[model samples]
Target chain A: MEGNVKLITDDGLRLDGRSSNEMRPIKLQTGVIEKADGSAYIEWGANKVVVAVYVREAYPKHAQNMDRAIVKARYSMAGFSVEERKRPGPDRRTMEISKVISEALSSAIILEKLPRAEVDVFIEVLQADAGTRIASLTASSVAIADAGVPMRDLVVGCTAGKAGGKIVLDLSKDEDNYGEADIPMAILPRTGKVVLLQIDGDVSPEEFDEATSMIVNAMKDISKIQRDALMKTYSIEGGE
Target chain B: MKYLETKEIVYPGDRIEINDLRPRNGIYEDDSQYFSEYFGVIQKSEKFIDIAPFNSPYLPRVNDKVIGKIMDIGPTMWTVDINSPYYSLLHINDTPWHVNAGDLTRYLAAGDFIYARISVSNEIKESWVSMRDTGMRKLEKGQVILVKPPKVPRVIGKGGNMINLIKSETDTKIIVGQNGFIWIDGEPDNVNIAINAIKMVEREAHTVGLTDRMGEYFKKLKGGN
Candidate 1:
């Protein structure tokens, strides 16, 4: 509150001039990288992320699952991605993010179909305002589909939280820094199954339910955008 | 049980049906419904429903013709990379001629390319390739190109018509391996023409009227010059 910034203006708009239920604009594109087996680039609000999937030899040979393929994911942030120059390599936060993302994506893929192989997904956050994890997860899901990995469904993720005693969807950087709570969630849009979820700060049971519904509804729209991008890339006519 | 129409593109989680049809490539079944796993065209057979992936990794199967590059020289065998997750072995016994124990490099060095066949393949081990009969031999001259493995069938066309058209039109000899590797041999200009045509086929494999379009394309190329 250095500038005593109001979380919302008197007109009920958030600091970024968005309604409490509004999310930032999102753009998703598949097959952006020519050399990768599958690739996608995403822009959500102020976050920019690119993900590439490689169909390569599975390493740490002993770890390979004989009945199915393993999905290994790595989440990395550029040194200049944030306001301060962060150090390169995996940090504690990125390691945790990578673990959750890999688990979420593993559920979407039909791993049993690909025996003794590995699909490596690398997510690079070039610019991060807030909700980088959700943006990265959304991009990686499209990349995996682009790679032609058989998946049970496409996953979409988003963030929601209580700001100034009011829950909001897709919080921006300012709201995230000063918001009362933050909840990051991901789901299999087709099944409405929550695959990844983490709550930070405080929220009552009623607030939790409201935030969950808000995020899920927003994710449905995001999933459609993801589908359109993929369909356009493959030149498939119309929507499903 | 009714199945989805053929050649209709399906995405992950899109339900094809709840019928008892056997699911094949790019499809998975659940307790209540059958869902598509890949983003590709749907193909239906009498007994099962399958999906032909637009892009996929190569998985070696028995009797598949492959073009490989020698990666390493072992004691009596040479390790070859067949553009797949699994590396194949070319044992000395599979070679057409006898090679003495002293030097195996004379037959195939570490950097040479070869046209071979997957003679033996199983889930538990690396696939073994043979240079025996099946027109398997060292590639002396040409450029190697890769297309999607699933699209290889389309590239060859029905009864090898597409390949024959390209070959006779461009005055080039082309060998299309089942593993999506194409070897072109001819004048550099003609080879380029053939390569471009093969790529166009690969990119538009799902489209209709491809053969006629390709014929017109070759005619145009020949007529323009």
Candidate 2:
């Protein structure tokens, strides 16, 4: 959407040649770990995430306990997750991303059963592109299931950003660099609860509304992908 | 009407009707009547939240069996480290005891693994425990075979259906802890078969109607029985 790239052209198409609201390709896998309660791997366009979940003893903090169990997340971008290498531990950006992801998951799980128990979700970004947060959240949900933490519905998180002042769903790396605004949301595909919501950059009330609408619509398609990944892992998808 | 008035009472982030400004902006604390789902200190505004002793999931449930290693021995209680969020205390009275009144070390001792059912788990809201169930016992050799911790539930199945089938077909004694460590004892060949079966069920439990196939595999194994 900036130098050497056009958000959209004379033909009304994006630089990636998709429509205004079109998203990139997504590939998902669940239950790759042999030890964690749950684990999953996901690839969205060029971004990749490996998430592991462990449900064990609850946090000892007297204040953190909830009527239901709680979900704690540690999201770290792997050293090689980008064109340029990142450090091993989390950066402030990754920490903020982790908080957003945990909040998204907390809304989807039926945590009351564990009472004081805790579910720890760890996400390591093997590769990253424009939509890493959305991809990480998506993979983490599958890993949470692999961890066997019960939930009423799976949480699906994604984003639709306003690029060059126009709404485009699922930003690519270059597009993110030049995008004017971005909004990432976590949705309960079943109940339509917007569990997590975040926005950055400049947008009017009207632009925000338009972008939100696009993200809500996109959840249905992404939800189907989520279900498909579950089926593939559980052997429920026509495996003998 | 009081609820509406309370809502109208100014908190930093209270949602108000676009024009409902009575100018009651007070510094925010837990002073209002409306209850929050969880607690947090107001960072900047009512809308911005960050709770302290920040919530991390830890709860206990009925029928949950976890893997724990013995850490210490108190005068009358076995201090067990559950390697989880919760700490477990096993009283001498809580076991299938066959020992003298105060000689605590020999009968159960430390560093030994035992399989016990969660007879009491009000852990989220209360402290309660028990080791009084048919499944409760001091685990024995043939060793514990562990799969991924989260895969334990799939291996055990609903109402112990998966575990019972493995026990009956292989003619082995297997105790599966909710923590994911499973103790098995019987013929070596049978032990191997049970372990393989458990892994098979785990790898495919996410499949729709696939447990039926697992049952079929067991039926063939039980043909001569």
Candidate 3:
């Protein structure tokens, strides 16, 4: 409604020239940081995120859990990651994202095996697009795996939204700003179990279901890319 | 009876296709099915299936020989950094010396290294190391290097062949700890060669015929020298 702007073109293509069911290109790499126990870098659309994982004895002694290891995910964005030159350090938004991410990742990791230990996940967003939370979560999973932490499964995530009365996969910056609804979802690919899900704006039950299904399907492909990236790190050449 | 090809790379949650064999380290069971728990290579044996992870934090276990650096000396015990998530304790009574309780530092001070066996480990990861066993004592003269714990076996090689080769070739006394700490003692030059060879083994532990490759590598080094 702002100056007759249209999120979807008359040809059914989104502003980024993507189809309704098309997602942004994604690239994942593991072992990017030499000093971290495990590390990964991801480039999804215009989002660039790096994740590092460290497993150590739980500190502050009181925080130690006798039954399992605790996950602490810190999601931070650089000052130059956004167009507005955001301030660095943890804000309310980042703290919320970190909390949800920590809970989601805790479900995938085998915490019981590492009693009294803590797995720390540091997610740094060097660049930001629209769906940075999902990108960071995806990269964090790979980093945790790279650290050789036992996990039930790799977590993959995607975003879907309703733009111009049509549900679209992977909203870009512009679409996210003006879209009718946005739904970001993450899941454990092995069991198809939803781990992290958030819905913003208004959508009917039918539209929500459609968006979830779209995100889940896109996540399957993303999951394969994660596996391939990890395999690439340990591929044997000319070895029996 | 083998199932999937041995040494196949796998990821966490990847379903292992095998029958009758039980799961071992790096594997977990879920609803009667077994899945890998680490991003590692699969190893299948006649009776068990295991995963060898590329990298992981060391977990202390009872009876595991470990190389530790003394971190803090208390009245009755010395806390040690054993390259694990959990720090282990060495009680004054567990040491070879019969020293007074208040004089722990007199026997083993902070910053000294020791070779000991884990005497007690609990579900919560609290562990105590002991130096009472034979061949377990303070490591006085050596340079310590750390590698991934999973690669310890490769450094030891089949029946100690690789380690013995390294020891004799470089003329260095070496001790490999299950906790991924290695102690090397000899001429500085020989120690350097031993360190390089051990690092190479850590880097290519997954590759086959590593012993043969290491033999050729040593031959080339000696020929060049």
Candidate 4:
């Protein structure tokens, strides 16, 4: 995809004018929707994702786990989310993302505490640039907390990739398109254990270590924002 | 056991260090790390640590006073929505008087609201409601307002201080359902005042000095109106 295009300037800044260590500005708010048990709206750069958490009776009579709860995550992109209007419904990419997101969420949740119940997380991406999956996963964790489900920890997602032969913390749309290796990872913030990992391009062992370290560092900051958003929603002074 | 600071907001995965600090509702212990399972403020006591969730769904329990709307009238029972996930059954046997099973609407019709008590709830969350000798009756000529169920206890205040104050000052009759439904009946203006006051309580339930704040709020509302 490189055709005499400059992915990085002479000043070591990316095309979006952000340093390799910097990430897009993130804004997270919880309890945005009334009906759902928990809801959050997130704006990370140009990507906008809203997540709603619902707790209901487990269905189909047999999917019910007698000793633990089931988590179902649905990830969808709006028709206008991308440059080309995407058709609605579960595409193959979305189905795969949904499965991974669900698994990542269950990693942090203490599902055994919620016996015979189902925690459903619905993530809708209204606008997308890049890293929409990570943004939605981060917001969905907040929605889970907002829903008051018992959990062991909050899950945080961040992406780091190799651009211009350098590992950057968060990739922009252009960086993602032109980057050699894109790694998206989710972690349990408390334990620092990686729960979800996906690599789009190739990277060496040394590059993988550097990329994961960068994402782990970025996750600490994003996790703080998630906790702050929940606190602000329930704080006495911030109470609505 | 020790406890966290009152009114401190806690999130999932936050560490709690006290060895004897047993976690209670909305708080859980995993290994040696105690964390909050919900997004809520800490409600700590010497006995245990509990977190009051900011917002939660209404789950029916036996002996709970509730306000419900009749959704459908079956042959021998009426299905009522108590703002819970499951529909509560109001049987004819629990009604004030015995009416024939075929024409059940003669006692209570669909879309009608009533104040009742949950008599029984099995393990599966199916609850049966009763109106017999519980001061329960059809709610007529009132405004039904919904708030978060967790805020109900706060609106009631210590020994019902907040609700009683609102009732006396506003000169309104209010029935608070544990399931987050409120029935207010009074002069139009007084009812409006009570409704606003309740909303304020629901919004600022965890804050201190709420009773005094509500008193001033009511005074200002009356003076302004």
Candidate 5:
């Protein structure tokens, strides 16, 4: 579907008239919702995700028990969010994504520090285009930071897709639909750990290498933006 | 009103491009031209005047007096829904005296009247506020009428004219929430009149001669006072 879009002309310039590999615009805000302990809303390209982190008092749940705190992640999109309406509820696909995200984020948290407590992370995708899961996880990490619960590293969620015979760092809504394969990963920059990994469509091993490197570089920029947003909120050392 | 063109305008939660700065608070600015009546504030820099539109301005700062409600709370912190893009946090640690974060229930309950000051704000707008100071006490004894969030200025009027009228009529304390929840503690009749008055203003917030209609209605309520 994205291939049919006039985003790319014969010259290969994409929609919004950017060259290949350029990402869409992103606008993020932390603690948007008052009710949630930690809340953030991010508009990455066309994908809009609202992430809330609840740092409740420690409680025991068999499935969540670990040496550290349990970071439970839920990723879902609203039914009327997309162009085509989607039915609500945790379908099989969403459950799989949730499991992967929780696994990815658990590596970044100092869970051993929170033995009995459960950190419930909720990610609601108000609008989705191509990279909802990645945006959700990225915003969720910022929400956790906004809540002031300590974490080992900041996570950057990015999707690398093979399109037009090239690996793109951030895929727009249109490119996503037409791209060959979308590899969404949650990367812990410090540890160089890949937490959540999922792919749709086809990619060669060499292309995977290009995509991973592209995603990591892009994530550094994303992390700066996240830190900027948080620093601006708290008016930390360099904020005005 | 005159406009100021600048490089960056500080919005409530974020920043807009430098070129879009108009000195109006309620106006939207974009490239190519300017529209009338949108308010903007001109900040004089070394070489250029920074034009900041009124729409997206900064959140509450420390010692800056603003009103909000107790939306939710943690063991030691109560969240205030300030009339800005970001939420405000009031911590129990910043209180007047020793108060345990775990036992923060009795100090402030949910839905109670709160007028606070921003003690700290983060890039995420994770603000920490304090009610330990004087004049930041709990509100009581009045009927609250909810209005739309953006219509606050209209109901309160420029320089408190609208709210002043209500206070003149009923001698009640009115606490307005940025989230469209207003707490008005007043007599039964005044409360009804005030609610209807807010609804009318919200409907006609953009129309002409609202001052006249509001004055006439208040006169009728006062029997030509």
Candidate 6:
């Protein structure tokens, strides 16, 4: 699977004609859902994801933490989102993504300030691309901030991988399927702290360093887009 | 440290550089650096720097006046929903009426609204609302509307000017809860006017000269009516 298909053409551009260090276009919008405390919608390349954040009293009478709030992130995909129809429920893969996303967000939110409460983040993927997980997490952070939940910083992420014997910034569908290695990374942009990092497939130590550095730099642009989306929603005319 | 301009929109994690001013609500300090914790507007005064969030859940504080709706009844207490994440408890002893245990419904039944003050709010977010304070009692014959809790102060205005104007102009009685629940009572038409005015305030709460704009708005409304 490593070199069966040509991901990078003779011109040194990937299947989408993007350079190795170039990312797909991403569009972010905040305050999209009126009923939700905070909401965001994102279109990253071909993947479309919507996220909502709800702050409520922790329920079940037992899951309540006396000292801080809990973060519960649910990642769900629509049946038609994939090339093959995905079953409409939380499968094992979805559950794993949900857990990682929840933990990653908990590190950024100031949950201690909201004692005995819970912040629920719902991520719905309307269209599936290769990097849905990172895109969903990015939108969830924006939604949480829009809900006005206190946080240390917004979480932003990107993916880099080795495809066609070349290190690439973002993985396309074909590259993800046939690529040699993939690494998804998320970080707190303010402090450059990595909150979530996962590696799949094989890469040498030097290649791993290059992949992570590429992702870290890409995350800065994503963070700027997140802030601009929030500013668009809350910016007042003549505001200083 | 970078100097942050006051009244500028800021998102969570944006650094706020203030010289010697203490961090207040909507801000947090880490490693001697201040950063905003909410997507809101920055406000700085002589002694403090705070962020006024565009929207946030209601967080109850001790001694704050609030309007609540009775959701469930118990033998000795009633569960009240004060528009916050935590449901407050209103005990029988806290009400003005002399009622015995197990007879709570006779005084304040489920679905009834009350005006009360938060008497106790613990570290765990458990709170108790008391109706023993002055002007605190069962709210009857009024309509309750909710705004974002963070906008309550702007609805009230500096020194209660905005709310007073709305009440006097529309000939209605309005009680603004610090938790964002507002009670408006009067003739149906006047109540509608008051509600509209309050909604306007909620929408433009961040803008300056809102009080003056509201004044002219009311005059035009009255002339048309």
lDDT of 2 at A181: 84
In candidate 4, what are the lDDT values of residues B16-135, reduced to their tens digit? Answer: 654676777876666756777776777768977787877766778899999999999999999999986557899999989877887899888998999999999866576899999558
In model 1, where do residues sit more than 4 Å from their true spots? A236-240, B1-6, B18-21
Evaluated at residue A151, the lDDT of candidate 5 is: 59
Q: For every model shown, what is its TM-score relative to the native structure?
A: 0.94, 0.72, 0.94, 0.90, 0.51, 0.94
Clashing pairs in 1: none
Least accurate 10 contiguous residues by lDDT in model 5 chain A: A231-240
TM-score for chain B in model 4: 0.92
Rank candidates by DockQ, best first.
6, 3, 1, 4, 2, 5
- True-contact fraction per candidate equals 0.58, 0.21, 0.68, 0.51, 0.00, 0.71
lDDT of 5 by residue, B1-225 (tens): 222222222321222233533433322232533322111233544444343322222344567655676778787678776654356777776666577877766877777666666777544334677777787766666655555344566677888887787667666667664445577766777677677777776655544466776787777777854
Judged by DockQ relative to the true structure, which candidate is superior, 2 or 6?
6
Tell me the TM-score that candidate 2 gets on chain A alone: 0.91
Q: Give candidate 2's TM-score.
A: 0.72
Q: Judge candidate 6 against the unseen true structure and give its global Cα lDDT, from 0 to 1.
A: 0.92
Which tens-of-lDDT digit does each residue in A46-74 have in candidate 5?
A: 78899888764344446544455677898
Cα lDDT tens digits, model 3, A1-240, are: 465679999999988899999989999999899889899999999999999999989998999999999999999999999999989888999999999999999999999999999999999999999999999999999999999899999999999999888999999988888889999999998888889999988999999999999998897799999999997776645432
Quote the positional error of residue B191 for candidate 5 in Å: 23
> What stretches of model 3 exceed 4 Å from their correct place?
A1-3, A236-240, B1-6
Ten-residue stretch with the least lDDT total in model 2 chain B: B1-10
Which residue pairs clash within candidate 3? none
- Model 1 over residues A1-240: C-alpha lDDT tens digits? 655667988999998789999989999999999889899999998899999998755787888778888888999999999999989999999999999999999999888767778889999999999999999999999999998888999999999998888999998998889888999999998788889999998999999999999998898799889888887675623213
